[model samples]
Target: MKNHFLWITFLLILSLNACKSIQEKANDQFLSGQYQYAINSYSQILEEDPDNPEANLAIAESYRLSNRIEKAGPYYEKLAEEDPSFETLYRLGLSLKAQEKPEEAKAAFEKAKGFTQEEEYLAETQRQIEAINLAKGIDNYFPNHVLVNYKDLNTPGADYAPVTSENFIYFTSGRQASGLYPADGTPYTKLFRTRAEGIRVDVGSIQSLPEFQNEEGLNQAAIAISPDGNTIIYARGNSTSPKDIPETALFASYFRGAGFTQPIWMPVNEDETWWNSTPAFSPDGSELYFASNRPGGYGGIDLYKATKLANGDFGNAVNLGPNVNTPGNEMFPRPAADGKFFFSSDGHPGYGKLDLFVAENDASGKQVIKNLGENFNSPNDDFGIFFTEYPKTGFISSNREGGVGDDDIYFFEDKTPKPKIVNVLLNVYTKQRVAGEPDAVLEQARVVLYDSANKQTGGDFSNTNGRVRFTLKPDADFTIIASKSGYFSKSIPYTTVGKTPRPEDLVQEVTNITLDTTIVLDQLILEKSIVLENIYYDLDKADIRPDAAKELDKLVQILKDNPSIRIELSSHTDDRSSDQYNQDLSQRRAQSAVDYIVSQGIDPSRLVAKGYGESQLIIKNAQTEEEHQVNRRTEFKVIEIRE
Candidate 1:
């Protein structure tokens, strides 16, 4: 028994030493920036000790640094559940968000905010929540569109960044080639030119640009050509040295007689430490836009522009500022022919990864950034959009699923028809009543349409036919008012919220429809009183009842519509109560009605409340119950009207 106990002790010590050695190896790999190798080491450790917190965190970080955030999700989730540290929770939220699990990610971020007091972390957590909310509503802004990948141009490897000029399309690809990049064991990216008809590219006509080919182990991608097709700017990376960080720069090439000249590095790439790539030329060729990771940038990568100088060299690079950049990468800056700018960003509130965005100056000359939304973007990298001169059709690169390569070029066409204008015809009529006489039409009435903001949108005088027409936009609310001499103005509210042409009905370029509405104004006689219908109250109650409030709401609207009118609101009671009691109760009720009107934003100075008890009953010597009910009433009379 004693010998067995000693042997057990020795085995336990040896096991602990082995575990320590394995942990040290994993740590060494992680510190040296070999994230893939570190992941392998930490994963092995986890196989034996699944609850190892350090190993789990390390593996998650490794996967994130290697751009495999989806693979890191489970590990981060495990760490967050076990440790619940602010860093672990934040990282888990990011992983979940990138995987399009917004609700779960939001919970993680919310929990993280409670654990940290740092302002930066708190602000970032709030931004993430806002971004998730914004992403949820992105579908509303996108038009109906479809994307089709160019299968002929894609390969089993990576193929993306397509630019078209004339009938030929230039793009970058990393397919089966003679040269390979040692960094990731993939073929070095090279430029290829092919004949394209619309969105179909002929693979058999593919040819390499011999004049623009790079050395064996370097990468060349993201090419831009001028409008004249003579000058070309392409990104080149120095990937030959395995020990040093790769440096990318932009190079310019000029077309010569029957060939192109040797590429020359641009002066804008003077900083050796910064990366400059993804060049785009303005339509007039006066400015070149590119993405760089240089110092003094607002984010990881920002869009910059360099103007063409008189001496044929480019001027200083200018940052596009916060409107065009964010705390994340902003790349692939492309300007359309109509002065609109397009780019891709991960910092903005997007579905995930890099989503496409468009920026343009509004009517007030302020830059507005709008997301391209789900139709033009996906929960993956989408960038490098180029449009034709008309911009009706364009090509965009995306790394979404269902593609043949790592990154594939897609074609999109705008199929949404223009909005049609709606015509609203207003017919105004006036009716004069005098002791059962026939009502006569009063022409030449003024009709005006007021928008929801109370601004007069359109107005006109009624013609001989008592009709006035105006054009209106769909999905809006308006109030139509009609008035004539010696007539009480009538106001009616209308809305076109659901009056647009339905999707199934819009089968043509334009659909015209007219909506006809009639407004009838009542003739107003001097000293005439109008009894408000359905104004009633419970016994001994001074407060306005629900039914009574509804009846008074029309008066409130009238007071609001006619701002210069002053009126007296009077209350009356039946003969059952004593004269003093009835007078006092009616006065209180009248004051209650006036107070309610004042509460609805009407000016108190324009209203006067009065009581005329059983002394001024409408039915003289009432006998039936209905007559008594009619005697107890409320009425309004216009005392003064200001033009």
Candidate 2:
């Protein structure tokens, strides 16, 4: 009986040792990033030791790190139920959020907040909570625009991140070449191309680049072609050899007529230990952008830009600064020609995971970041966006649910009813001399448009219709000056303020509206008497009346506009008054008018006060009161125009 008991105990000891060996193997697999292998091993242990905390957390982290975040949610939830620490709770929230379970995600984030007093941790938790709220109302954005899968370009494997250059579309796809990458369990991707007409991709013409860089089991993806399409920059790596530290570096390959030349290692990749990929060029090809997790970054995997030197090689990389880099990963930089900078971010408050964000400059020139919102963003991984066309037409990448497979390429267009187009056309008609007579077209007159700052924005000569047209900027102030050799220059203030059509008021694709104004320049005719209209005074008074002062203001503007002209502001009296008395009274009235004109900031030397009195009367012997009254008047004539 004693011998039998010892045999059973001996077998139990052997079984215990075997279990320890299995645990060590599973740990090794997880540490080596063989996540699927780790998951399988962990599952076997969980069948016997179902409550093993180490096994559960390892399996959950393995799933999350492997891009199986959807599968990680249940494990994270179970771990959090057992022990709701900050890390577990925060990770759980991330999984739930990526899966589009906003309510549950928010609840998890709220729970995470209670688990820590560290500002960074608490802030991250709060960010997740705010992102949940952001997702809740996402449907209100880009109302009519819904993202459509590029059904022809997509495959059962992943196909994403397409960019257009001329009539060709370049992209990354996992279906055609290379072996599986254990990281996401997807086939290694290669750079591919096809013919494109604007946003439409010609799927049948899709062709992968020759294997001049990555080997059979390696990967090459995320490309940037120059505006001339002569150069292509891409990421190539994934050395599976256990002896080498895993590294992905950038390579530059040139178009050698029919195909790409073999890639050469880029010098801008300063560190081999850091992960660097996702190359993009500025619309003008002056700078190159990529994502890197090198030291001195704001956080994990921050975006960086390197300037293209005159030698055509990239210079030192620069961080996009605090406004763009968050404490979370930001990648896939795409700067458009429309002055908008786009990239994917998990740092900025977003719907979930990596959301598309556009960085814009406001009126103050401050950088403002905004989510692409709703249709362009989802709760899953969305990154690597490229413009197939400008003004909101593009191909986007997302791993959102209901895709044909993992990470599909989606075609998007801004279909918000073409928006409201208000074309504010300013038609400036230059007419003939003073009093705007003849109404004949005046050609060859120089017309200049200046902003409120007196800076000339545009200048053009009057056409056959004496018309100079310009498209006015909205909510602006401008001054239009028209001048000719024999004519006095005239400055007119034109304000576009309160003149624009509201966005909601325009239902048509384009609303054409014209603002017509006539600029009549006076010919510099010396001694040509031009009567001033509506110049009147209280009966028998020498003091300038308010009405008379108002008329004199026009003379002030003319003097100001034609800086070289000296005008004679003269007044005459009726024949009834004694010649000397009328002369004295008229002289005082004319002087008073000159004084008012001087007060309006016109140069004093530009005026001459003259009084003709009864000597200048039209009716030699006025009998009727109307004829006598007509003899009292005020007039101005250009006496001298100084050079």
Candidate 3:
């Protein structure tokens, strides 16, 4: 009997030895990233011992990495059921999430909280729970307008990080083919630009910027442009050697004509070892926000802000801390018009893939990070986010299937809820409530303003029947300048102390603005008629100059935003031409003004164009020959007020 017992013990020892060997081999395979092989090895050990937690967990991890998540779920569930721990619960939660059982996943994550004493891990679980809840509520965001399927506008690649300046929209695309052959003979990612016409991407034209291309690198990804379009910043890396330098740096350049000049790398002030990328600038150009994976960071990567020093150098960088960053990888930091920092992260518990999140500094300057939710995120990598300043149409990059390639850019109409009333109406003349007028003159009458720094702050034009309004920005400051020929020029310095007044309170608020009647100052005027010293036309053509168009568009917006005011469009010419000929030429020019406004959706009845010819010449004909040039002009006056 003693000998028989010895034999059984000996057999058990042999079995134990064999199981250890299998577990060791499985672990090695997993570390080497041979997921399928590891799964097979782990299964062999589990066959010998069905309740072996280590072996079961190994199999689950391998299956998870292989994206056979369904197969992973049962194995992880068994391991958790046998011996619940933080690691086991985490794996179980992740597996259930992959299987689309969100409620089960949440329960697993909550169970994980009880298995760990680490505050960091506990906070992380709470964050994940919040992310899941926020994602569940995403369908609630209903935007003002949605442009779902427009042909030219919707490209195939993952396109995002849009920066608009003047008439151009610059963005990054992983779908565009790079001319150079990658190591595997594949096209790398690239950056492309198009016009912002708000249509079927009827992009007047499309062309890749030479400056943004990385001849033999991973590909330039995130990009940001300055307000005036003069400067740009982008992120660049070498994909072939991602770990050689795990992160990317920011580069800046000046726009020289059609191309950008040589780009200059922007490095961290004191630390050159770490990497910096995804640069976003404040509207006033005073502050810069970027992503970095430098040492001392809260986690994988964190958002950092650098203020411009008085000496024209960037200040030392400041990490956003626990509020904005997580233990998971957080990259692609972009600051929106509302001063909120938008970024992408994989560490937070999310629906899937990397999710987009926004971090903002509250009144006390404390940071608050909020997951943007499923509206902007998918079950795939969602990065390179950007939105328009005035109208919230923007784009995001993703590889979430249903796309053209591994990645495709999706232009999304921002469905974020906005304030009840967006802008306030304005009466620029005499600050009185002037309403109702013919369509033509009313359409042409508008106001626009520029700051000393040449930035457009507020103002929009009117529609038909003489009315106008304005979309007041947060704390916008500008010098309001009004223009309409036959009347005098007007200017007003305006400033808003706090956030824009809510839409509900705006109607009852009396925001008054007065405009001067255009006066043909005899001594101030040069010759036969007052000339448009600021209005410039392109060479040998009647088409207004590009700069002139920008100026006029601002005026058009002023009229469109406000309503109910009338004006007379008039044109004058130098005394050199016969009265009859000058009169005819002036009238045609006046009509041109009428046409542009009408094309912009303004009413035709509000405006009336008339040629005064040399009759209203501001300067005497006897002045120097050069003086006569000033007499040729175009003007507008508030001739009639409807209400």
Candidate 4:
């Protein structure tokens, strides 16, 4: 009896200490706005005492804040799995939708409607489910969410650009588990890899890319792995350039074997003042598309393609030409299995910087770029796209405000479309019945184009040519309204065929109308450059921050979009700093920007990073604090480039 009592007392004390420790950690993290950490702390308590309702609720709240809805599923599911409370069921629906399981996600949403007056959330879920259903062209929605996280040492930094092969995923990262190391004392970035263990639903464990590691240079970012997982092509550059030092030309290695053999650079014929990076091998591995800043471009950087010869040498890179190479920058070239090219660009109108876009290669082999619409875009930077080999699920990276750093990865599965979009076209003209050179409406009219339901479709206004072109979703209804300041908006209704057409869905626009040109309006197209009030690092420090990455990404996007645009990345430091130290810091900082741009697939030749240091001080004779602040700055100016 004495021994039993002693053991019970010891257990009680231990439990109390554990609970106290958890509470303290939770409070600390909560006060610090580290909700994820706080929730993790609370989770430990729940693990010990499963009935801790407060802990469960805290986890749910954290999940909501962090947009980790799938994580909230079990807590809510536990409450609703049996009798199903209205709150629990509603949350369950949200959780499932977040998991990208729309059908089951919809069922949970519908079930919640049976108990609560708050049907708004459920209604939204239903609408999304419906939209996904329609978009996928499926009778019943399929649950296709695969968990993909590539782990290993030889893998480069954050194994990203995951290209799925039937049962495996080929990706790039800088981790060393694969035993690859960069030459020189340079910080490491290498393309290490792994294989997925299980079927589509459960993406099991990852096995190291044993064959690819410890090569000559570190194979870091921008990977294009073949669909069969037998081949890989990735970007690599000199470590002396550092992460921010943009190279005049970036090199790529063609990887063979389950593990890579001695990879070779894609010959110097593609080399120009600009760098060649972000190599994407086609599904057949016979073709390659990459970004380059060589001369004869539209403006900044452009995507180019080269054919693989039977001798394993690449043919001269053919310029993708005007259709695909805009005056703006284009990078992250991904050739989808369906023959469409998916890439990230800033030249096209999108939600924000570096939006992901898809383009179809016409029968004539011309590239036509189209935005993926709003679902996959946000107001912040989005890039680094790759899909899982499992047919639909995969990941992407973005620094769009809500992530932990400059770039955060997101996993999404294909929301199959029900009815497909066959084709779509919109025309803008001065509203008048006059047949030839009709001139009744306002000139330079600003037209805001929208999709079928009035959501913004990515398109531009009537150019001097007075025309706007767009690709349409199949089997979808589209409405277009054209307006000037004074004229009543003209609404045009059109529908596209879902399946093989009965020939009824196609329509031609001959309808004409006269518009009132009386309403005068001022339209301003804002093309704003990011302004740095002041750029300063700690004394003698050269490390780049996540915030700097955001700004650099914007600059990079601009360069990629405008193929002919060239700019010098200038770095400056405060006059108070020693001249030599300031100069070195400035140079490193400028180089850092260049390095990041090169990593993002921008051709380095287009950019020149210079360390101005205190040489270009904005304020002369810095006696006051405010004037001294002016000496620290970084700026860019466009240089000569081809049209």
The lDDT per prediction is 0.80, 0.80, 0.62, 0.58
Query: Candidate 2, residues 418-502: lDDT per residue as tens digits?
Result: 5566778999999875363465678889999999999998899999999999988767899999999888888899998888787
In candidate 4, where is summed lDDT lowest over 10 consecutive residues? 1-10
Better of 2 and 4 by lDDT: 2
| Worst-scoring 10-residue span by lDDT in model 1 | 1-10
Question: Top model by TM-score, which number?
Answer: 2
lDDT of 3 by residue, 1-643 (tens): 0011121122122334566777676666666555677777867887888887666766776675544555687887897888777877876776676556778888999999998787877877777677667667554232343423233444644455666666667766655564422222234556678777542253657678755444455667677777666777777754545354434567677777988877676655345456677777777777777887777787756778898777544678888777677766687777766667778886665667567777778789987766666666667667766566433676666656566555556676755555454333334432221226321333444567576586876565544544444544435565666544333344556654344565556663344333222211111121222233455544223455666556556546545533455556676777886889878777776777777777788788877778787887778764776676567666665555455
What tens digits encode model 4's per-residue C-alpha lDDT throughout 392-468? 66676665544543344566666553432334343555333233553444455455546666797764555555455
Q: Mind giving the per-residue lDDT tens digits that candidate 1 earns over 70-121?
A: 6688998898788687777877888888888999989999999988897867
Q: What lDDT is reached at residue 468 by model 3?
A: 47
The better candidate by TM-score, 1 or 4, is 1
Rank by TM-score, descending?
A: 2, 1, 3, 4
Sum up the clashes in candidate 2.
Answer: 0
Q: How accurate is candidate 3 locally (lDDT)?
A: 0.62
RMSD of 1: 13.7
Question: Would you estimate the TM-scores of all the predictions?
Answer: 0.60, 0.68, 0.49, 0.37
- lDDT of model 1 at position 211: 56
* Model 4, C-alpha of 200: deviation from truth (Å): 6.0
